[model samples]
Target: MTTEFSPRLFERDSEIRALGEGLLACALPREAWTHEAHLGACLWLLSERPDIDVDAEIGGIIRRFNESVGGVNDDTQGYHDSITRAYVAGVRLFLSETTATSLVERVNAMLLSDVGRRDWPLRFYSRELLFSVPARRGFVEPDRMPLPVAHK
Candidate 1:
């Protein structure tokens, strides 16, 4: 019997790693507008990882964020509200015909520019949500990039 090598395996792993790197890159300080962009990139990555339950994870993040803040009264609560909006936008983008490549590039530019560094917590969580897709798919390597710092 002859052994045949399947290139698909390598291709899939490469794709997963690329997505993981994108998520890591998005883990930067951000402003309110960047939230939707970050989530958009996340949706793109999640779409590529069918094994991960995107809806459930998004729902849990929203629920936990809401429960943690209770209501959108203060700045912190307002930040969570923006994250909710971003999440909604992400879902919309994921279902629509928009291209993920363009959106990812836009997100990268915005994050690198540090347009909104004040809202680091929201940005961190957004990236965390994105990272979860690869993590769930078993693509995350602790040594590759440090996990997002926990927001108090």
Candidate 2:
């Protein structure tokens, strides 16, 4: 349960905020998962719990996608491809170069591996996880700070 912090993680605050805002904007209707939002969600997860088994977790996501969507075809393959790309891009953009490179390599390897062959039914999975799990588990949103008390 130790947390890992990186300056690179904080540097992407604006991007994370924008993505979160986008999710909020689409709050009425379910939002599609986007690269930015997924990246933001992963970034939050990494900062909060660096010990997480990313490969296993994402592999499970692929499995969930398979169960939910059935088989991949011409229409759905693009979404799978996009999710892989987004997963790599998110790691690269939000993490330190060394960490990002290692993660991207691992994720790329996973994508090449048999288990990573699936993708989600809806992109909102990342958004749902981002918005729901942390709150329910009592995890604080990364980069959020308490407001300072006002002086009279």
Against the hidden reference, what TM-scores do the models get? Answer: 0.29, 0.32
Q: Write the per-residue lDDT of candidate 1 for residues 66-129, one digit (tens) a residue.
A: 3443433233232233344334343443345333254444343333332312333344355564
Off by over 4 Å in 1: 1-37, 59-86, 89-91, 99-152
lDDT, candidate 2, 1-152, per-residue tens? 43332212223445454543443333311243443345554544454345655544543443344344443423324224334434544343334433343433433333333223233212323444334433323323323322122122
Pairs in steric clash, model 1: 30-116, 31-116
Candidate 2: C-alpha lDDT: 0.38
Kindly give the stretch of ten consecutive residues in candidate 2 with the minimal lDDT sum.
143-152
What TM-score would candidate 2 get against the native? Answer: 0.32
Worst 10 residues of 1 by lDDT: 3-12
